[model samples]
Structure formats: C-alpha cells, structure tokens
Target chain A: MTNPGIRDDDVLKAAEQWRREGRGVAIATVVQTWGSAPRPVGSHLVIDDKQNFLGSVSGGCIEGEVIVNAGEVIESGKPRLLEFGVADETAWRAGLSCGGNIRIYVQRVD
Target chain B: MRLDLLADLNAERAARRGAVVVTDLADGSQRMLRENEAASDALLKSLNVRLRGSKSGVHEHGGKKFFVELHRPPLRIVVTGAVHVSQAMAPMAKLLGYDIVIIDPRDAFATPARFPDVQLIVGWPDNALPSLALDPWTAFAAITHDPKIDNPALKLALDAGCFYVGALGSKKTHARRVEALKQMGVSEAKIASIHAPIGLDIGALSPPEIALAILAEITLYLRKGEEASA
Candidate 1:
C-alpha cells in the first residue's frame, strides 16, 4: 500500500501540473482538527476548473462543500479559511455527524 | 510560490534527501529547505527535530505560524538472506510502507518464484551492499545463519549507519559473532548496536511469527530506541 504522505505529495504534484496546463486549480488543506476527524491535519484535496479533484480532506463528510467553495476561490483568486463542526445546522445535511470539528484552508495555486 | 521550487522539491525527494516545505500561512508563500542547508538556522533547527521524528505539523516561531511539511525518504529493509523468514518479512514490510531489497548469492534460494514483487540481488553482500548504499532510513537483516554471508553484511550495515541491524542466531552464536566482529576491527560500541538472536522475545516459533517479531523490534527501535526495547 502507498503511504498517505506520498499520496499527499501526489496531490501537490497534480495541482501544480493542472496549473501549468492553464487550468484553474485550488488546494484545500486540513489545517486543524478537533475530536474524531477522519483525516488528520495536513491532509489535502486538490480541485481544478472542471470540478475534478484528487486526494481528500475528510472521509466523504465535507468534500462537496469544500469543492463548491474551491470553485469560488479559483474564480476570485482569494484564499478562504472554512470551519465545519457538529454544531452547525448543515453538519447533519453534509454528513459530518461524527461530532468532530475541522478547519480547512483553501487557496488558488498558479 | 515559484514552480521551480516545486521542481526542486521533487528533485530532492527523488534523490532520497530529506527536505521540509515551510509555508507562511499569512501570505501562502512556500520555501523548500534541504536538511543540510544552514540558511535559516533557527527555523532549520526546529525543522530538523521534526524531520528526524519523521513528522509534519504547524509551528509558531517569531510570532508567525508556518506549516512545516516534512519530506523524508521511504524507509527501506535490506535482507541479506533469501530464507523462509525473509519470504514472509518482505511482504509484511511492504504492507508497513517499506521498500525491500533481498540480497542472496544462491540462485536457487533467491529465485523470483520465492520472492515476487520485490527487488532481488543475485550477488554476495560485499558486492551488493555498496550499490544498495544503506542509510539511516534503512534496516538490515542478516538471516542466512552463515558466517560467510551474514558477517560482511552486518559490518557494511554498521559502517553505513543503518538504523537497525539484526542477525538470526542464538546467544552463544551471537557471542562468537561478536568476537569475530572484534577481530575485523569493529568497535565495542558498534558491535553492541547489533540486535542478535534477532526479534522481540515474543516466543516466536514459526517463520512468519519470527518475521513479525523482527519487524516489531525494528519498528520499536525506529520509533523509540534501543534503550526502550532492544
């Protein structure tokens, strides 16, 4: 099996490659976590202009929202710090019902 | 951040040199620092401690927060014998995210049928080890139970500063091996580094069990130290 860190490296490389190909790319990274977050801090999800993504920040709990926000970041060229937790009303809708909290930082890379 | 920095980071990783990518969170600027460089002494010292532990995390220094991403070379295991224990150990090591290389001069024992999906060197230790270039990320296992095969490899592993060196032998056998290493000009300190009667004392009897014990001991040494569980 491949190491998780190596897989993260692949995400970085893919993000750089997408940017070099003139596709808008944004990298969403898990900067902090509390309680039972599935993936640890430093985990990354790379998204491109075509809504394609590589790697993951959460275990299918928050990727859709992050991807939608990443689209806006790519269009505006502004970074964002997003927070999600069980206390939020959208947590149940987004499936983050595991009673954990996470902070993700998203930024465009070119 | 410049794309060339990413290229250089990839180059460092490909060369098996440890590096750290320090990202200034406030500005999103990133700089790659090789382990040996001295440009950022204070930050490098902090980064070196994290790198040695093989961990990556955020750190605060000088009122600024930076994400220190460590890029360490993959851990490696070099088995000097293609014995039954090795057959079991190689795949287990792979499962634990280790790169394995099996070295044995015996054509019959070192056949691909015995060890598949692993790098095999059909040469003696003295010939194969130089190219393997054992380093701190490497663990060396000598299990042929032959003086001609195991001794030279242990010596080379000691010289190369392999993190773990293990040999399969009983207590008496290890005592004699120690004397032989002394005759070959190895110091007491270096000879003490060898984990003879290799593996943790888990009362392992079968080959696979012994492989598990050995891997456990190697992991303990890598994470902790000889003082903790040798």
Candidate 2:
C-alpha cells in the first residue's frame, strides 16, 4: 500500500534532490494555524530558485505570496516567518479567503 | 538538510522501519532517529512517545522548538481465510490504506478474480504467516472456522505481537477453539487478546456487513489502542 504521508516526504526528497542538482531550494512550512485553516500545521511547500514547487502550505489562499518570498529566501540564504490572516492588512489583497490565521516558516535548505 | 541523514532516513523507510525526523526550527538543522535508538537517546524520549502513537508535531525543548515528523510503516492486514468475508474485507481495508494479503490453501477459493489487486498466497497458515513476517503494524483476522487453518495462524500472530488478532466463530465454537488453544499451551493473557466471534456486534446478517463490522473493530483498536465491542 502507498504510505498516506508519502506526499510530504516526497516534497522533502525533491528539495534535497534540487539542491544536489545545483538549484537553490527553500522550504516553507505551516508552523502554526488558528481556526478554519485549510491545511494542518506541519504542511509544507518546497520551492526552487527557478520557481518550480511542490506541496502546499495554505491550500491555495496564500501560496503565491509564499512562493515569491521563498525565491527571496533562496537568494538571500536567510529565513523568514510569514503570517497571514483576515487581521493582516494584505489579507484581502492577497486573497486569503480562508478567514483563518497561518504562520509559515521559510528557510533555504541548501 | 544533510544528505547523509536523508539517505539513512530513506533506507529505514524502504525497509519498512519507523523513524522520526527532528528539525530544529531555529537554523533548520535536522536529525533522524531510528526506532531502536529512541529508547536510549535523551533528546528523543518525547519524540519516541509521539512516534509510538504515530503522531507528529512541533514542540519546545531546551529553549529550542523542533518539528518532529513521524514516518511509520504502512499498515497491513493478513486474512487467514479466503472466504466470502475476505472478499469484502480486503477491498474495504485497501480503501482505508491497508496492505492486504489473503491466505488459503484451497486454490479454487483463493483466486485472482475473486480477490483482485490483493496479494494472494495459496498456502496454509503455518507457512504463510512466517513468510509475511507479521509485526506490530499488522492486523490478523482468522475468518475460517476450521481449527487447522485458524489455530496455527492465530498462534503466530499473537507471538509476533500483531496489534490486532480476531477470530470468527459462534460462542460455542469460540469456547472449543479456546480449549484447543490451551492444549497448544497458549498463555491466558495471549488467549484473552483474541477478539472472538470477531467484529463489532453490529447485528450484521450478511457477509459484507460482517466484513464491515470486522474492519470497524480493527480500526477502533488501531486508533484508540483498545478493543471496542459495539
């Protein structure tokens, strides 16, 4: 039987492979969530410097911004803790329609 | 983010062994701890507890927060009888993310057409159970009432520490089966572990419903770490 958590593992494995292949990679993980979050706290999204990505951290509500920030993290070799919610000023502009709060921790894996 | 650590973790997963990856949330330093090392590693004591429950979470320890990711082997079910109940149970278990293997010596009954997309072993329990290497992640069901087929398999499953062991029979049949198990020198606690008359008492009248009840019982045991009757 296929392992139910294989997708999560696959994302990590892909990140490692991308790094080994000389492509800068970063991973964004949902470290915390409050009410009505589409994904769980441990959900992940792995992104490469070329904008290729795998997995999801917020279903579809906040990935576009996370992916953009991930590219910056890859280039800077720095980490970021990004928070989004209806309480944030960019919520409506970023289309965080889930009406919940999420904290994403992004870091360069290489 | 260590390649060697990832390689070792992959190897453990490929071998169907459980492990936990603890990632330091501060700097992204990661470490993989295998099942055997969890007992002696002070840093892994709390992680080991989560691993036993098959859970993953973020926790704070020593002023550092870590993300503990659990990687458990796939759940497996071994059915001793290729009877009608096995037909219904195998597919349902598969849908619930269980790897299924059906064993029955009767070639006519244990066929590809009847149990499509499942591992079929046309062999007796004595030989088949050993080859399968039953472990804590596996659940065993003896649906065949025949003593010759069910008795040996139940013994092996209990001895191997399978998480769940169920037998199918009426009250009288179960009593006789218990006596026979005693004759084979099975301990009282081990014999008590068997869920006789198998499945939850859901008032099931047909083979498919009975199969559903059995799967329900197995799921309850797996999730709650205890038996549920109805």
Candidate 3:
C-alpha cells in the first residue's frame, strides 16, 4: 500500500522539524502492497528517536525490518526502499502471509 | 517533546501529531503578497480567523512554521456494486485501513447480512454518488457489470474529482464503456482516467483475486500521488 496524504504530511512535518532541530529523522512508507496485505499504499509509519514509530507498514511483520534498517537510515540520512514478501521467507516469519508483499521506502529528514 | 499548538487551531483534535504551515494567506487568495513582513502579518491574520490557540515560529525565509499535529480519520473507500467481487472487496479494503461504503441499487445485494461492517447503500448511483460526496482523498470503484448504473455513477465521480476511478471488466468491455461515455459527452481525457480491467495484471480470475488486484491498483494510484507531492 502507498502512504496517505495526511500521513505523508505528518511525516514531512516531523522531518522538517527534525531537520530544524539537527536530529536525524527517518520516514518509512508502504509504497506497494500485494495480496492479503494489512496496510494500504500511502500509509505513513514514521520511525525516529530510535525505533519509536508512528504508523504501521504491516500488522507487525515489517516493523522489525524497518527498525533494523533505521540505524543505517539514521546514519545515511537518505531514502531507501525495502521489500518484503513470500520471496523473502525470513520476512514471512515476521507476520505476513505467502504471496503478500510490501515495498517500504525510508528517508532521513535531518 | 514540544507540543504542536498550531494543529489544535486547525481543528485537528485527535492528538495525531503533525505539522502545519503557517502561511500568510488563506486558501482562496489569488495573488502572492510581496513583502515578507506583510505575508507574515496576513498569515497571522488568517490563522486568527480559521484556527484557535496557535503559536508561531518565524523563519529566515519569513514564512512561519508550526509543528502542529492531530489525528486523521481512517481512509475511506466507496465501492459501488454488491457483486461477489465486492463481497470480498469490502472486507479486504477495510483490512487495508479503508472505511468502506458499498453502494448497490439491488436491495438483495446491499443487505447488511451480506456485508456486516460495510456502510450499505441501497439507492441508485445517481443519488448515491452525491450523498457520498466523493473527495480528492476518496477512492471509488465501480464493479457493477451493468453500465446503466455504472455510467452515471462514473460521470458523477469523475466530475467530483475522486482520486481514483476504477471499474471491472475486460479490455473489450472497457472499450465499449468508453464509447458509451463518449456518447454521453464525457471528454476523452476524462473517460481515459478510468483504470479499466481495474487492477494491475497480477493474473487474477477469481472474485477474491480480482478484489486483490483492484485494491493493488488503488494502492498504486494513492501512493503515486503521495510520492509526487513528497
């Protein structure tokens, strides 16, 4: 699923604030969703101040993936896309079913 | 953590944290204000009119930025059709965080017994589309195979500027639909907006599969708009 307008607006707001404050902020978005997915496109799930987050990419399957990669995002302060689905069985154990896929894009605000 | 006081003024009461741009002009202003100080004054003026309890931060650019936040409503989806595909679609759309409303003219098709969580509408598309008030934020799907119902509904939705307008049918069926719409004087550009054979070609055949595909397409359209703005 993609991120919604309001959610993206929130993330943008947060990111800009982080930039002003000189603190790194990472924005994660569910850009693509497949069969039986939990969240829609434009679903905003913001991760900052460690793993503290707002929004959801999946039921819970992809949060850890987001969290794990957040550190890199925090360091790089650039956007990245992470994909999870049946193709990645390791991701399935995280919570999603077979055939369901999601593309999460992460960007650092600060 | 600093509170987003400007958000409170925007009537965002849900405590969903967000930020607001403290612009110097109201939404309807046509010309840009020339002076930075003048713009700031205008923004302060507008904020006083539309929002309440707002504190502003002045920036080097002279544009005020306030970190205001409030909860947003759940995404809404309006599905027109009580067909089997819609049966799978309503719940599926909900699972993806959409507040689903199903509109079908057939009383038997729009029964609450069939779709318990759906906001069921047992009215013709002509009446239903207006009452629903499809917004740019709303996603609409017309899955009814009957063009008589789907056409009027589509015309209204397109005119209303719904973000996504998709319909179910094969390419041939969609081409015929285009002809019908053209005869109705809908511009070719407007008629072209319909995502015919609605859904990404994930090779769907079953009702559930078709619903999944349609939802995927909707998701794509929604995301594309978000990313463009970002």
Candidate 4:
C-alpha cells in the first residue's frame, strides 16, 4: 500500500468504477523490460468499456496505444499483447523516446 | 459520478480472477476504437455499424458481459511506535498513499508537530489496540525496540490478520524478542510472521535508508501476493 511517488488513487478507483457498469475492462501489465523505459516491470494501466483510463504502464507513450486498442478488447472479450521499442520511429511518435523495449499484456476482465 | 456501481464491478471481476479498465467517450462521436485481435476487430466493426445505424454514442458494452469495475480501497498503515524512526517514516508513508496512524504512550514523542497528518494516540498497546480498528488488509509495523510496546502490537497485528507486519532490531535482538514473546504465551507459529531485523539486507546505515528498506520490503510482500493471485 505504501509506494513512493504514486498518488491520485482516484484514477485507479475511477477505472474500477467503469468496470462495474458492465463495460468490458482490460488490464495492461508491463511484464518484460529492457533498456531505459520510463516505467518498470509490474506497472499497471487499466481501460474500461467507456475508454476511461487508470494507472500508467508507460510514462505516457504506450498509454494512448493501449487505450485505443483496449476499446476493441471491450468488444471481443479477448486479451492482447502489445510491444513498443526504441528502434521504431512510429513508437517515437507515440512518445516513447527513451529507446528501450517494453512488453504489455492486455487481458480482458469483468 | 457513478462510484458505487463501479466498485461493485471491480469486486465482481476480482472475484472472477479478472481485472478492470475504463474509457471515456464524449458526445457527437462514434468513439469506436480498434482492437488488437482479429475477432475483436470484426466485433468492433459490427458494433460501430450498429451504433452508427442507431445514432447513439453512449451505451454499455455487450449487455454487461464484462465486469469493468472501478473501486480502489484506501491504502492504510499502522506504525506501532512514535519514536524518531516513525517520525521520519510518517511523511514518506503519506507520500506513498497510506493512511498512517501512530501508537505510542510517550506524549513527548507522540505529538502533533512530530506527525502533523498522522493519527497519533497517546496510549499503550492494550489501550490502543481496541480503538485502532485494524483489518486483514491493513499493514502493520512494530518499530519500537521495547518488548512492552512491540509485543502487544505484534499480538494485535497477528490477531487482526494484517497483510504485513515488521519489526526493527538486529537478528539476535529479534531472536531474543521472540523468545521473550514465547515466554509471554504468544504462539510459536504467530511469532514467525514478524519480519524481525526488519527491512531488506540492503546495507542500510541511516534511519532514512532503514525506512526505505522497510518500505521496499512491504512493497515486495504486497506485489508478490498480487502476482501469486494474478
């Protein structure tokens, strides 16, 4: 419960609220990592059916992508795997300028 | 706006070994998002077609088939000592999102200035335990080196099913403390839960480093439990 530099618990609570409204929710977990990523492994970002966001998987870079794809997760009731790397120019466009590799697992939950 | 229903959804999902995510869609737009999978792509397409045909942008997903709950419990911590270590620890704990409460009998040590935001109690363990109201989810740490302060607090924590319970002392000190507790009729099994010689072996020398080690160990325990369940 005591974590340094984490606050605004409301964000997480808000994400939880959206899930209860019968919206498909997905949890994006940072499982594997390499190089200098903004967030470390075990970081979490959640998206609900309403496209509401909670937590942070990437500092900002990957959240938009995860949220955009999470909408599809709500519809299909399936999970997804997403990856972003420093080598990709398009990923740089998404805001991941750190040039490290990170893996995200998006699992659909109630 | 709608907090209770969201909390319920999260509870349901957690019960089912699942997780929750939320999104926001504004007015006058389809807000249709692409899926990462083929089947979901087709499904979203159909859903978009249906929504576009109906011209309604606001709706729940698939007759509530998924549990997208939104509730988070407040993080709580009970520090059983208002000594200098606890003084240094309280603000850091607050920064980490914990509702910190301090218990100690010494009025000089447990005052408002030392811990401005924390709930300070000027009472011994026996007097404090009843009113503190700890639960299974709460994290407890016995920072007092004294047996009178640490022992009763440890008893309360073990009884309440706290998620984390740690104490400060050397390995030898902890062993002696445990032996003392057994003499006081505390069970051998319950005595095992205390993380004596508290904090990780990070070669911490100062009070702050010691606090960091303690915080890190608590995080490890919690995260490990989370992974086990997930």
Q: Model 1, residue B186: what's the lDDT? A: 92
Per residue, candidate 2 scores C-alpha lDDT tens digits across A1-110 of 23244466677778778888989888898877888887876678999998999888876878999999999998898788788998888965777787888888888875
Model 4, position B53, has a per-residue lDDT of 14
Q: Name the regions of candidate 4 deviating beyond 4 angstroms.
A: A1-12, A19-35, A40-42, A46-52, A70-80, A105-110, B1-9, B12-77, B94-99, B130-139, B159-180, B192-206, B209-230
Cα lDDT of all candidates, in order? 0.84, 0.83, 0.66, 0.66
Residue-level lDDT tens digits of model 2 in B76-111 = 999998999999998789778798999999899999
Q: Sort the predicted structures by DockQ, highest score first.
A: 1, 2, 4, 3
Error of 4 at A62 (Å): 2.9
- List the candidate 3 regions with Cα displacement exceeding 4 Å: A1-110, B1-73, B226-230
Model 1 / residue B195 / CA error / Å:
1.5
* DockQ score of the complex predicted as candidate 4: 0.13
Best by TM-score: 1
The CAPRI-style docking tier of model 1 reads acceptable
- For residues B70-182, could you state the per-residue lDDT of candidate 4 as single tens digits? 22345567887888778877887788767788999988888998888789988898888777677655788988788789888888888887778888988888888888888
Q: How well does chain B match by TM-score in each candidate?
A: 0.93, 0.93, 0.71, 0.69
Which sections of candidate 2 miss by over 4 Å?
Answer: A1-31, A41-50, A54-63, A76-101, A104-109, B44-48, B226-230
Q: Compute DockQ for each candidate against the true complex.
A: 0.36, 0.33, 0.04, 0.13
Q: Residue-wise lDDT of candidate 1 within A9-94, one digit each (tens)?
A: 67777888888898999989887788998787768899998899999988888999999999999998877888899888886678
List of chain A TM-scores, every candidate? 0.93, 0.92, 0.77, 0.81
